[model samples]
Target: MDNTFDKKHGHELLKKPQFFFGMLLIMSLLGYVVAKGGVVSGIGILAMPIVISYVYLIFAIPNTGIIGIYILNFVAIGIVRYVKGVPLGLTIDAQFLLIYLALFFKTFFHKIPWANAKNDLVLLAAIWYGYALVQLVNPEAASRIAWFYAMRSVSLYMLFTVPLIFILFHKKKDLELLFKIWAILSILATIKGIAQKMFGVDAFEQAWLDAGNASTHLLFGKLRVFSFYSDAGQFGAAQGHAGVVFILLALSQKRSRRLKIFYIIAGVLGLYGLMISGTRGAIAVPVMGFALYTVLQKKTKLVLMGAIMGISVLVFFKYTTIAQGNPTVRRMRTAFDPNNPSLQVRLANQRKLKSYLASRPLGGGIGSAGNWGLRFTPHTFLANTATDSWYVMIWAEQGVIGLWLHLFILFYILTKSVYMIMFKLKDEEIKGMLSPLVCGFFGIMAASYGNGVLGQMPTGLLIYSSMGYLFLGTKLEKENLAIKAKEQLELAQCNK
Candidate 1:
């Protein structure tokens, strides 16, 4: 009777389409909310659809469809943006809501069979939470809103999005589809950046600066190209990362000549976008990402050669008129000058932070530093403090303990990914698939030394999504190998 009941339940689970359809319906409703009102009102209305979907998925689909909903919502928003003329800001807000809904729904699907927690990416999440906990206890940083803000940022950008993309996207075809979407959007963004550079009249940039009462002079004499993203910094960093990824992927493809050519074009356009944004920090992304790739491939000689070549190029650019003639190039040169007012100010701020953090070792709390803290949690230590670097912000807000955990998580992910590349897989296509992600991790890590790319949407999304793919790829590879071995054994037994 128990076996029959189990079988019946399983059969019913397999037949469930309502759960999936309901999820799409909820996403459509959320899309409508975002299209009508902005993010604030949209969040208020998001709950009902989420609740209804959750309940339906729980009783109907055996596998929690939260991740599916998240992806569906992402694709839906893209569709809405293309079809409804919804503003990027509104779309971003809607994406945030979808992320929250996905997280909430994931609770029901948390027990679904997938990759283990020891996976490098999962360890990264653990490290992130550990830092948050430290921030929670620090007296100097006891701001509830700050915690929520941190949670909101991390949850929406990394923790939720990455896992969902990895778990839900099971096929190579799906991965290709996602990459294609990413490429198309990225190319569009690059075109916008190029336009901004050429004619200094981007509606998005002007609107952003006017709304914030901020000036673009801080971006140096070069025109700050924002594209469709929130700021020039984010735009530049994202383009830089995407440029490298596209280029690497293009180089990796053993087939599809036309697609390879398109990728190469996309990569060049992306680099142009990065350059026009006038963010000197953006340069580090490709350097670090490529360096990581070389190191992981056990090409120590290649790494050393690349480093020497990079130094040579830097020296040439510095001494030659080739870079000086270019507006973007001239602006990037400012980043190297210690006497540059911005650099001086950042250094002074770091000194102040060092003194402050020395006594209050536990930190002020998460989201208590940078623009995020000022806007979201004004009561925390860094709410009024100045922290230019992401690492400094983490150190000031969460202290040494928090910083350690964060680093540990990143290192853990790096180690695991490296192991997978080195030992686990021999397939070139699989290696190519993983390369961009590994490079992205390195790029973000290096970029974070100067700016906070880790928390921002594009970079964060890329990181988590790549991490998810890494985890899933490793798991699938192992499963396939196991099944193949089992099949061989069964065939041998039958032959005997």
Candidate 2:
């Protein structure tokens, strides 16, 4: 009876053979891997726990994953400079996959409001991605890898980004946050460019210049100022796009004085970055963006003022010798010249491409014309044909059909956005915020006519994000009205 008063508990792990032996086997295998592969494998093993937490974080806070994507879009290409052979791109793909996995797990407790993503923007992205996918079997395709690389920016990112934004990040605060993030990054980029301009290139940047980039980045003994971006052309265009959006933002606001100052400073920095980049086409970003922005304003007097300002800029560049001593202005001034050597070169390339693509309506393939073309299929006709313009690259790779479809999608989006901004939306603040995005988009489209920045990093993702937010403008306006109504009712009741 006394012996029955006490009981003994066995070790739980010892009781379960699977649990005991499984961990032992895993440890043994991991030890073998670390012994064979050395420190790198051990580092990876140590990092596994951290990687596993990605799902927890993503599901817990949806926008964390989304913002990660934004950060990746900015920094992905820059990784190539440091990590030589390893594909840093895998990180992006892995991040996207983890995001989707997190979203999947979230379905156990909550429904992802699919209807919010059911819009023309998402549909258009899908259609474009579908088109890119079809190129996998194109007869003219010489490199499947190139198609894989090209389509991600050309369509896949748009497809992935648009729906995620609609479903998760569609609020007004999300937009404000996005703008702030964009402005901060743009400002940082300018500062970096300024650093490079004043202090000279670092070892990595110098190495980059040594590897054929010197020809472009170091033009005629002068630095073209690529900053930290993939190239000067991209740096210039991205800055120009940001510059216009922020400057326009400052102009549109009246009450938000601090915000206005922030916008102005960011805008000015972006313009300075663009100038130092020495990419002639970047000037068109502000020119075309402001043109569209003035129209979006829908006030006759403001429109007239915008026109006057535009004409003044055009005249200043075209007619006057103002600031000819300044390298940036002198470089930008050439963009207005029809007979400029660079313009002539571009024209010649287009003509050659026209003849080559005469028989093949789909052009060469998804990645047959741009930087990827040079990498994957350098011997191909499309690869050798310098596709200076983003639209031209699309045409050279995806053909006339792709170009027309792309144009239609872009124009349709702009038209719809304009209509909503002018008549449907009532909130001045929301409308004003959206105006720069719309204008920036138009500006980028215009810039794409001269540089392949449209489908490039930072710009493509930014534009896709902007498009998604622009479509949600009406919803944001509704929320603003509801909040305002609540505030007014509370005020009246308090007075009573």
Candidate 3:
């Protein structure tokens, strides 16, 4: 009698006495849990049935699993603050893997367009992953466990995400939906950050701050609002990334007015989150993103206007202490200051790493730098060193050879995507839609110099998705053109 039953799942099975008994058993268990514990505990027990339903839904519809992975990527690390002891990060891995597992079983009947994922971008990701794999036997590697954990961020996510996007989620509609989801999450994050700013931190957030996070988060007197992200630095960078991407979308004349307004709202709120975050490094995201966007315009007047605006803002921050009263502005200005103590300290550390890594062409190996190094080998020299910059982490961990390879891959994507956007794509609308991906990619790359934001959660996955879609430029344009042609043909026939 359950409306949820389908022929595929055998609705007739409900006629059997065993089925009735099974339903009664489940109901009795739920009731027992509610009686013994409380509503919250009963709800927790219900999760098993819900999880089973979700598992079945994802196996039946692989795209839903992709959505699960995307949503989880944004919230996974933050979930740690609430849910203690569970390896929530692993769930992100599991979600994406489920998508592929479903696809694997499906391959027995359906012929998947595997060739869609064949491209330089995916190849480069594989090559980077292969490099990490090679680091397993790195002579200087202090911990295999470290390599396993660090490599997930370094290469594994990219390897997993890009191919999945190209093969499964390459449609224009899918891309638009992804961007809209991004905006919604960003809006929610900012709302959380604003609450933290206007009122105060919650119990969980306060506990996080008390547990040594206060050192970095609590500046002069202002609390760097981190929202639900791992830290203020990540929150600031991610918000600024959203700001750049959405503002670009808002500027697109080809998009609908409703979407444009939504993009504007998300963009402004994102910038607000960036301001409250007090992460000086994140300021680079907007500065560099807008600069790149202006140049991409290739119009003299627009470039000149952008330059003028850029200079005015730079001079205001660098020369005049106009907003010195404001903590956010004050902290951001330090990024431009050459003699700032923290910058000097970071430079000093880089110099030390340079001298240490110069002798070893292969360097300290994967997980030998950053938090992983600090954890697995606290007494080691590199472990004591802080890799403030993402590139520096790669250099310290992977050495000059690996650094060169990494740079090559990134630059190749940036330059090639630019060429495709600038020349290869015909439709102005699609170009506008895709332009933000390149701009945001550049912004994150530039910001990565100050903080290791690029390879971190959400940003890394998003970038890999961008790379996938950007490479699908020609195909997307064809689809766009087809739609336009159909519309025009309809109009002509209507005129007749």
By TM-score, the best candidate is: 3
Model 1: runs farther than 4 Å from truth?
1-111, 114-120, 155-157, 202-204, 212-214, 217-221, 299-305, 319-321, 376-381, 476-496
Question: TM-score for model 3?
Answer: 0.92
Ranking by TM-score: 3, 2, 1
Model 2 bad stretches (over 4 Å): 1-50, 493-496
By TM-score, how accurate is candidate 1? 0.74
- Model 3 score (lDDT): 0.89
Mind giving the per-residue lDDT tens digits that candidate 3 earns over 135-177? 8888999999999889998999999999988888989999998
Residue-by-residue lDDT tens digits, candidate 2, 415-494: 99989998888899888889999999999998999999987788988998899989999899998789889999999999
Q: What is the C-alpha lDDT of each candidate?
A: 0.68, 0.87, 0.89
Q: How much is 392 displaced in model 1, in angstroms? A: 1.3
**Tens digits of per-residue lDDT for model 1, 1-496:** 3576456454465467986687789889878877887764565475668857765664454224433432342243233323334333344445445544654566586754345433556556655765566566677754677676565454444655555554455556656766776777788888866776677754434554666625753344556776666567777788888888888889898779988988888778878888888777888887777777777677779788878877865775555666487777887777656678877887888888888788777777767787768887766556777676667777877777667767777777777777888788776677787787778777878888787767765566667767777766665566556766899999999999
Evaluation by TM-score, superior candidate among 1 and 2:
2
Clashes within 3 Å, all models in order: 1, 0, 0
Worst 10 residues of 1 by lDDT: 73-82
